[model samples]
Target: MKKKVLFYLGILIAWFPAFSQTDNSVSAITEAREQLVRKNHEKSYVSHILTGKRYDLKYRGAVNSQFFRDIYPSYGTLVYDGVFFDHIEIQLDIYQEKVVVLLESKNNEQFVTIDNEKVSELTFNNYKFVHIRHDSIMSDGLYQHAFQGKHSDTFIKRTKLKKDKIENTKMIIEFVPLDKYYIKNDWGTFAITNKKSFLKAFQNSEAVVSIVKKNKTKFSKKKIENGLLKAVSLLDPLLIDN
Candidate 1:
């Protein structure tokens, strides 16, 4: 594997001259060259290290018709086996609870899944997620990283429940979200659902509430997290520090 990784990277440096030939100005050439090399390095790492079984596009008895967020792939970054890779094409299968990568070859599209254990952190569609085994904060699985504060942090665990409906003659499958929110500080991790629960988690509810309002954080009852995330972030520093 080590030899393969180097072999793939060796092919990338071979095109270093292209960066200089494109621009006569030194600064432009240097900046542009750095960007190109970085992108190519990511490609090399993705192609070499991240490889697995074919990710079938067709639903093979998947709970919902669309367990995936989108049929198309988006570019994102991830940490695998302590190595960080960026600018790679990816898709999230929330129902299956797996990370899939899209690869291209000879004018054809291919998809593959990375090892579950190797994926520790990932970002896609503007959401950051982490999977920790044996976590004291909550269940040892995937959690959408909502906020990372100085003394504390917040994580949201979202799960899609399977639902079936009859649409005409055909049976249709759908996914509905059931999410849990958590606040973790130096002391412990607590599942906070609303303002009352949040206030109860800390010793001084009034002080935390005051800071949260001062920060102008918003939460409400809707198809949302009810504002606990921003509240936790604003109050953590004030509450934990004192």
Candidate 2:
């Protein structure tokens, strides 16, 4: 199994040079090449290739519809396995919770899913993803990383997909946002559905609550994020220096 994976991974890397020949792919390729030349880190790098079963468009049971159909050819940047790759056109498969990148093939362009375990941080479609340990647990997974640099407190958004039935004849897919706001604080991860809950979760409750109160408007997801950023700025020094 390892040999098979490595073989395909090699093939994928071989095609990378073709991408570099184009002006658009030069920045990312040059960056990766420079890193290979300069960095002394010895971590093993893997370029995941979309194989027969893992390929989404050709998969059997997957819904023909996708969460990111509306947003395609969206160029972005990502750091995978500590190597910087930029100027990538990608689509977010929210249903499968995967980042799909467009790659060139002999026949045409193909869509390949990125292995999330290799992704350190990714940004596209105005959303950011970072590996995080949920609820202060040891296990790390990807979340729409919101606020960073607040050592003890980070804000993130988690998403999931829900399938809705359209009568008995058809179906529709929806990107159901599950608990869009969360505060990973010193205690643990806490969902922020309202102002009171937000105050109770963070040690800097006064600053957080004050921000909310000053808004004097109905609470919203955007407001929660803005408030968290402010509160995090206030709490960053204490959390980081400790």
Candidate 3:
């Protein structure tokens, strides 16, 4: 009788740990989802369709355009214009021992560092002229039809959960292409003028997203690269023409 009791007790002990782990996992997912929802509601977190110097010069296919090289003084600069009323600049500071992001705009400037060490800085090229334009009337009509109504897919769901001890997480999210619609509609005009620049600029946008998603310290470069690649693969297919 005692032997049987001991056996059952041992089983219970083992079972409890597994149960606890499962519960913790569920709780983590819930928390992550909540965080993502909050982020989605925040204007800063919403994806913007931007038109910028890079877009204009690149779409014009001026491969030799000095503007292309001039914007990125360093490889770490990421610029997005046209989503908001102005441009959004995100700069990664790699000169320091740690990696960080610098976010800047006309009304606000701040540094957001990962792991509390590296500082990212945001800057606007004072020499450059920033032009802000509303989406073309046709593009605006599509935007309303696709995203503004009850059927809108613009508000995407994103979740990130740490999957390994190396501080890397699995991020799953939906991305609606707010810009692609305009691109597709205007493709003929833009492509004819600047095929090379347009292609390069599009590729650059993909690269920037990869960098943002894979920005981390603990993971190997290969692992980070793979993560970014996987993320882009999943999201790219969901982008619509409008």
- TM-score between model 3 and native: 0.18
Query: How many residue-pair clashes does candidate 3 contain?
Result: 10
Best by lDDT: 1
> For residues 1-242, what per-residue lDDT tens digits would candidate 2 score against the true structure?
55655565575588798886788786766676666534323334444443322445533333444544444458888787677778887666655667777777788877777778777887887777777644453246666766666455564545455656575675544445453666665567777676677677765456555655665533466576666666556655644333
Candidate 2 vs 3: which has more lDDT: 2
Off by over 4 Å in 3: 1-126, 134-242
Candidate 1 clashes between residue pairs 3 or more apart in a chain or in different chains: 219-227
Clashes of each: 1, 0, 10
- For each candidate, the alpha-carbon lDDT, in order, equals 0.71, 0.62, 0.31
Per-residue lDDT of candidate 3, residues 105-199 (tens digit) = 68965544333111112233432211112433222111111112221122111112222222257333221111221122212212111223323
Q: After superposition, how far is residue 240 of candidate 2 from its true place, in Å?
A: 9.9
**Candidate 2 displacement at residue 2 in angstroms:** 29
Q: What is the lDDT of candidate 2?
A: 0.62
